[model samples]
Target: MSTSDPRPALFDQWLPAEYRRRGDFTVLVVLVGIDTRSIELLSSTFMNVIGDETRWREVRQLFQSSETDWNGAAFFPVDSVIGPVPNDMARTQLRALEEKVRADRRVLNGGHFFDRKGRRLKVEEIVH
Candidate 1:
């Protein structure tokens, strides 16, 4: 996907093999966008991966509108959340959540998360 594409493409590196058998997983998504200088986080959400289709649709709609310029998103499985928090807190929480998921053995080697246009974004492109 191009940087100007409003529809964000999804990526995940640690999806487990038994995801389909285990059903939906809860996650905290970090939306990203690229400007002239760097890739930046645009928004965050605490939601279920499969059950929150409406919410994901809303996010895409928002991106299509004039309100946002996001082009990509990454999802991380999180155990819980205390409602909306600041972006700084969300980033910190994401790290902790990743460790938790890793410890729980919920993450595995090669699995697909979700992709909008079948474009896999490079880590260097997303991480500033």
Candidate 2:
């Protein structure tokens, strides 16, 4: 593959992987200019990036129950640091992430979604 190959380059940061723990809605991690579908593709790479069958299995379970494209929320390691990212921090992280990745050239991208009503997002808004 070339420099522009669609595959996500080896991830440098071991930021926590996570999944939705409650309602049907999901939060996504993505970049502004990139296509959402392309960002969604990273779900398949989580297992490889995670590099552990047991770990992926646990993370997989979090998403499998939802009507997700595996793109609903973040993916965390099953054994440690594997759970929901606090919504406030998640939003803050995304705010500066674009610039952070550009300076560092990391393939990091995703969205932290919420509802239009200024409240936390619900399942309907997330899955549909």
Candidate 3:
């Protein structure tokens, strides 16, 4: 790994042998925003696969800064963090979760999704 690479260094140090040898894996996460009245789903993505430094930095800032707001809402992680799943499996899981969220009318802000190589993708591109 390059010293300035945006992928988290901790994963390089701690990832299991199988995944480490393969170099990258997909992890799906859901972020939620909460106010006095409601907790709404903010975004869902394989954020760990993002390799763009600027975008990664922005995401890191949001994840670390509690007061950051998105569309007048303060977002935070919910209980759902899935994977280190294989690439194909991650897509399947993401599709299923997107369906459930759509059905529930819970998605607030849209999300970023990426392939193992850090290429941005549309939900339709990934799911089908």
- Per-candidate local distance difference test: 0.46, 0.32, 0.41
Task: Write model 1 residue lDDT over 25-65, tens digit each, in one string.
Answer: 55565555645555555555554445333444554564457
Strongest candidate by lDDT: 1
Question: What is candidate 2's lDDT per residue for 6-92, written digit by digit as tens?
Answer: 423322112222222231222334312223322322222122222222333444364555444433333222222534355555555
Over the full model, what C-alpha lDDT does candidate 3 score relative to the true structure?
A: 0.41
Question: Which of the two candidates, 2 or 3, achieves a greater TM-score against the reference?
Answer: 3
Kindly indicate the candidate among 1 and 2 with the higher lDDT. Answer: 1
**TM per candidate:** 0.44, 0.27, 0.33
Please state every model's RMSD to the true fold in angstroms: 10.1, 14.0, 14.0
What lDDT, from 0 to 1, does candidate 2 have? 0.32
Best by TM-score: 1
Alpha carbon lDDT at 50, candidate 2: 26
When summed lDDT is taken over every stretch of 10 residues in candidate 2, the lowest stretch is 114-123
